[model samples]
Target: MLAADLEYFQDVQNAYAALTNLHCIITDKQGNPITQLNNDPNVFHLVYDQETFKEVLNQWTRDFSKINSAIVYDALPGVKVIICPISIQGEIEFFIFAGCLLESTSKNTVQTYFEKILQNPEKANAIFTLIQEYSPDEIQAKLRKINKMAEVLIEHLATQNMKAHLVEQEENLGELLHLIADGNIKVTAVLERFLHENTKLDFVGYARKKGHDQFVIDECILPEVSSTLKGTVFSMGEGTLGQAAATRIVRFWDHMDMDPRNLFFQQKGIYPKSLFCFPIILEKEVIGIFFGGSSQFVRLENDISRVGKLTSSLIKVIEGNRFWQKQSKNNLMKMTALNEIFQVMTDVEDVKRILLIMLDLSINLIRGPFVAVIAKQSSRNSYEMVSRGLTADQIENYSSDISNRYFHNKQNKRFYHQQPVEHITSWSSKVLEIPIAYRTECFGFLSIGLSEQMLKEDELSFLMSLTIAGGVSMHLLEATTKVKMGQTVIDLLIEHQEYIDPDHFKQATKARELIKGFSGFSTYGKINTIAVKYSCYFIKYDEQFLTNKIKNDLIIDIVREYKLVADSKLEFSQASLNVQVLSLVWTYINEDENIDFLLKINGMNLPLLNEFLAYLSHTTVVESEIMVTNKPTANEPKISKHLKLSKREIEVMELVLKGNNNREIAERLYISEHTVKNHMTNIFQKLAVNDRSQAIAKIYQMGLEPEDVS
Candidate 1:
């Protein structure tokens, strides 16, 4: 909201003036009268019309806006002005001079204010009597009333703003369509007006990204700015502005005058107390950075949020520009790329070769930057993946077995998924997934990261056709190739057990095992998978590498000593491959004990096994959950809830039972030690105990159970 927005309502101004006997006028920041809202301006005319007395009038209003409150300003001896500052978005732009009257204390000597400025003192006796003596309390009451009226005014403006914004959005869509059709990328021109109309900042800058790290200022919106800001180049990650671009998150910095990180503004002789940086994002990539700041501290509403919405809408309107058919450039290539995928699929019998080519074709057809083939864990207990345009780090992030969790119970057709930021370093915003399935059995997933949204009807049809053909071909080809893969330990169980699919991992209720320090568990009919990675073959790094018969015994002892019933394992002995990957899925016939958490707790528990995990590298202990029946099993401990505790506190108590110190538990949970201590403190208060030992005793007495968490 701006001072100009306040001027739209004239009756509100008159009503305020009528409530108190005072001339109501809008004045410049320095207090010079600009527009009169009420008829009580004869006093104003006498002051402004008088050449010598106008200086005194200016002195009355000078710095009134800076006061930040309603005040009875003493303009001259025996005279005062009732003024209230109208602040919009924390910037004082103008003042409302509601009253010009004689002061109560100077009733008899009112002629003092007019001694130098009054040209005809005897003739203006009636004008002096027209001015009435006003109490400060009355003016204060009137000011409070104006505030109440503003509350109502704000509600009215909200409804009107929504209607206006809709119209503006429609118009902006039109502007964006023309730009897209013309192939022009001057997006700043479309965004500039909204900033000017809705905000009042001391300095506003727009920097366009020229390279990966380089950004050059294309424009700066401010009046009479003397310092050089435009054409200034800033690297990504240089300051708060760079951080916003790097993280794609909006950030605000305050007290920048005292911070050396404000060099961008400091160099321009503009030290802002509060500053905001917004990364202008398109297809999850920051093309520019928008900067806004005030030399003084100010409050912010959804000004940035509204602009963010508009910017998103801009991307959509251009990317999905309904007039796309008018340009034959994109439509011309749709069929050619569609034809190439079918030609490659019919002749390819190798599954991975076909998958790799399909991924490449997806990138070529859609102009997307990334594509991946995410396969479900095979019998060897490992997921085989092939990707294009994705880094090794990115590929690792996607191997989170999202499909295993996402498709547990429900079956989905071709779908679009926006990749969430797993951490600060990775940005994978949108992906289109086409499940590679043979009938109901989903063998793998085909995904394409969308650099442009809204696939054309024909383009989507072509992708669907390719995936359907590829799935059928891959499923038939895997029949013969699957014979030589590594086997699952489920076959080695003492009792013959039923076969289970690798993807069906339970997610809820089974987390009950966390209480007893088991990493993750399942009930009667459910199963859980625990994945582990190794650097190389056992022969290459281990002095204890054994023959085929001894190797099985060594691995079984190493695993059983840690209380795990290994359900599946994969070991690659080829000299050509540098790394050997292993995924462990723990399973049992009658639900025998498999304590997964012990491996992490025992820092030096298994020297040979720890060597297998790697002597130095960080071993991540991530847990995946599965849902079992709420009914407790025969061997499961039945504990009752007797005291109030938080979910985290109960989990902390579980780790305490495992004999883990505070530091170990902190590392295990990926939380700070301070947070673990806080949970411990809460646990102490709930159990009425002061130490870990006493709390553990009380927990046992209370019969702590998984369901007891409340």
Candidate 2:
């Protein structure tokens, strides 16, 4: 039995992959994986995983030979498995096979097979969702092409075997293999020298350019011939080189008249009696073509054994070069894209405009045709308000479906899921949702379509790293902008502090009431803290307790004035002047103590904001919280038995005690307003109270305690 090492088979497998979509596997005579079976994503995984399929595949591998060519076996429903035999020293040594090739036109049958295997309808549906369907004729044509290529591959392998024995005896031939295998010389250079020395003929090489689909003359001897053929493009099946490439077989023309499209002879006018052509194949597909011609009789068939071995070695080097070149290109593109993103975020001040740029550049960065940025609203579900390459109808469709919201998770999360659209002809149905976030705060999602030609795992990993960095950069920009605005507010407060007179109680009261108009920060506790802390600079500690009374009376007076302004239909900005005045008064009222609170509230860097705050304010000793009692409470006997509220009613009443409105209470408890109102009515009847104020008063009066009320 002839045995090949795992590395050798792996090289062959990689080379064959460049030529076709069908998964190929090379195995030893015993049917073990050559270099370990590819884990489940490959066809071999399926063949090896299922016992029924494995038995059929193993039997076919054993029976395959040069005599029988190959044996067809069952793999998946409607999919055919074909194994071609490789012979070495007059015995079958290896078996190469292609699987998951559809033999029937029915896609349903294929879907059913996967459904049975996986037992998941959704997964089965998704497997078929992204598949580009092929007709029966197309499938048959593909199979025929693959089968012919397999036959040529088998012949090439046999030729290598024959040449191996010859190489052991011939030192020059062994050196040629060593040189080409070691990548010391280009495969074309060695092939050209070998052909001229051994057969007295020049070699011509044709390979596809990196980005272009058409084949071009790559390497050749004969300066005149090379000059004439340079820059010439050949489409598949157009000329002799193309024919050799398309067929993946040796093409021979013993007479000049036999091949009319042979460019060397046609363009350079160098007529030869015989010409030999062969394809440079990798992974089962043609990557380049080779041609050699002689002015006299040249035994091409006798030399095929040596030529095939050299060609295989050349393929390895070419593949390696292509892989590195593609990686380099992708890295450069990624860096350029990331640099552009950084520039836009750094320079752009408008958050909306910055977001738009981010959404636009993300499409090109990921190479996806469709892209979108979906942000979650505070009150409702996440929505797709902005998108690129999507129609109005598609946007509307996405907005209505809650499932389309991929950025709903409060923590940073990512999803790469395939979404099936009604229109299959759209750019792509596959989608990836990457969370745009900083730390634990997710701002939005970057959604993009997935292309069929996806980035390799390493490239994808690099892209994800950049994406996370980009998200953090965006978050920092937003925070920085807020800090800048807060600084502006601080400047306004310092510049206008003298405009308000402390002795002018009307102006002071008006300012206080306007500040109270801002419901978000007008709580009794917050107002008292602002007053006590700030007024300490202007008032003594003994009189500091009177500052709270002054702040409270001013707020009450301002509220009465605001109601009069509302009755007279006053301009909002005029009413807003009161707030502006209050900001100045409060700045002075809190004295230097407002610095820390302002810095914390605006999310500014503590050290930096402290420096600015210190430079703007007159330094004063900041006091600790002074305990102050609210409305007097009278001790009462416990009356817990008199109030029998259901758990839900007590929950609502506790929210009422915290001064939450009906909507806020409902939202906090995750209930409806109508339900909250019903709870309130029940609590009112249980406590024999008229409104919220009396209900709370009775709860305190009865001294009824509730568990976990807070």
Candidate 3:
């Protein structure tokens, strides 16, 4: 689709060049080569690469749609120039370029150039001399007439093409109109075909008013026509079309010499005897004059009126079609814009690429000479160029200036409104400021040079969508990175724990505090569960004894170690060992056959133990506790009541009644220094004097024995 559009535009440009005897080329706003006719391709490459040249071109296109022979010296090093902007559908689609003169040239070259320079002082001087020799007043009048003719020529061409494009729904009609208005050969062919088929008169040729003063004709058609009507404009009330266009009324001349009322008609040259003029009314405004004349001396009042009516009706139809076509095209452009945005969303991941794509798309849609994405800098004097169409060196220079003004100053957002800079080049010749913001966070300002055509709502909406989409994607990417980091830490913790020593597994549990905190898993239950799982092997290996004393010692040790790990100053005094005893009993019964000595020593019977141990080994400690606790509590209260003595007394009586040794209690408690002797002395005194066996016998008599406590 894009290629076909370019080809159509190229054909029109070529036709314009051939008919007008002028060089022409079409270029993008950035000065990049799109298509060229009767001009060097390298010219576009050179101009586009030169920032200064592009800036000048941008300025020229902004002011007018046509520059017949205007001089623009800033483009190539050794080139004179005439440039015109060819706007279509509210955009500068192409520029018409002509002339390339070197600084130094031969006399013949200068003469050729002089003839083409429309208002050159040298040519004016020669014409003025001849007029002064003849009649000074007449000379001044002729000069004015010539200038007016030039203006009319330019205006006629410009308005005709604009009007034709306005009416026709034909694809590439804009280009076709441009070619016809410029008096191209193809347009002449088309007009010749129309005239030959529609009229009996010998067609002289066609001419279009370029402006208020100048008229242009197809130089290619001048030779074949019999009359000298090419490249000429009649003074007001002088010729058929000129009189009608100047007076804004219809005019007809039956004979050049015989018509008494047509005082402006001259008999000095061969001229059309009968002529009719009609005003081309467009949108209730007379845009130009249309003349259809012949040498047959025939009356054309009815034909003139009919043609005038048809042309007027045609203009109205064109205007209506243009209005709706523009509306529909804009709608299509908006839809295309939406589709492009969707594509960007799914295709881009790299932030830099996304930003560049956004910038490129914006420039294309808006048809601007420059577009850039600027990122906010942290420093007060610097900003980063996230993406831009400017050349590398140009971007570097612009970045340096932007850094000094906005980035270095640490301004959140700033607008540079039409601030003229020698360095930065764009189409507007004036800077446009648009701040790039997401929510309240301002990234930076996006700057572009708008041509004569301002950006529409759809263009702005497209830009806004790009900014929002880019910001959201960046945010999501950052969040994903953090999540990945967390997962990595968790994985490392799990891996490292596998290599940790069973006895030193407590350290791993302690280290998990850091991981839990990092991962946001700081709830009490969760922390406790993790700590227990991580340190379970250590507890099982070291504290497997079910005896109350040993279990009580282990609990004290565990509490002390926990306090040390926790870095707490608070001490854990003696606590009941019942829970530890139950835990230890469960651990021993649950040990596998390979470590079954643990169960054998805990009072398991041989064959029955073998069968039960196998079954119990597969069971969890929690499940075994459920089984044990559910057995029976019937005799438990009676036993608990008989063992109502103080803890120290129970210790002494159990040892003494068993007849082992008094020294054992003292050694176990680490309370030495006659503590065991005193405990024995108190036992005998409490039992009413006695030997060790008598004391034990009395304890049995009093029903205070191991059976009751157990």
Best by lDDT: 1
Error of model 1, residue 143, in angstroms: 5.3
Q: Against the unseen true structure, what C-alpha lDDT does each candidate score?
A: 0.52, 0.51, 0.44
Q: What is the C-alpha RMSD of each candidate to the true structure, in Å?
A: 25.9, 31.0, 39.1
Candidate 2 lDDT over residue span 398-463, tens digit each = 545423344543331433212112222233376665555544455565566667876455444434
Q: Which of the two candidates, 2 or 3, achieves a greater TM-score against the reference?
A: 2
- For candidate 3, the per-residue lDDT at 184 reads 42
Indicate whether candidate 2 or candidate 3 has the larger lDDT.
Answer: 2
Candidates sorted on TM-score, descending: 1, 2, 3
654 Cα displacement, candidate 3 (Å)? 90
Worst 10 residues of 1 by lDDT: 490-499
TM-score per candidate, in order?
0.33, 0.25, 0.21
Worst 10 residues of 3 by lDDT: 518-527
Ranking by lDDT: 1, 2, 3
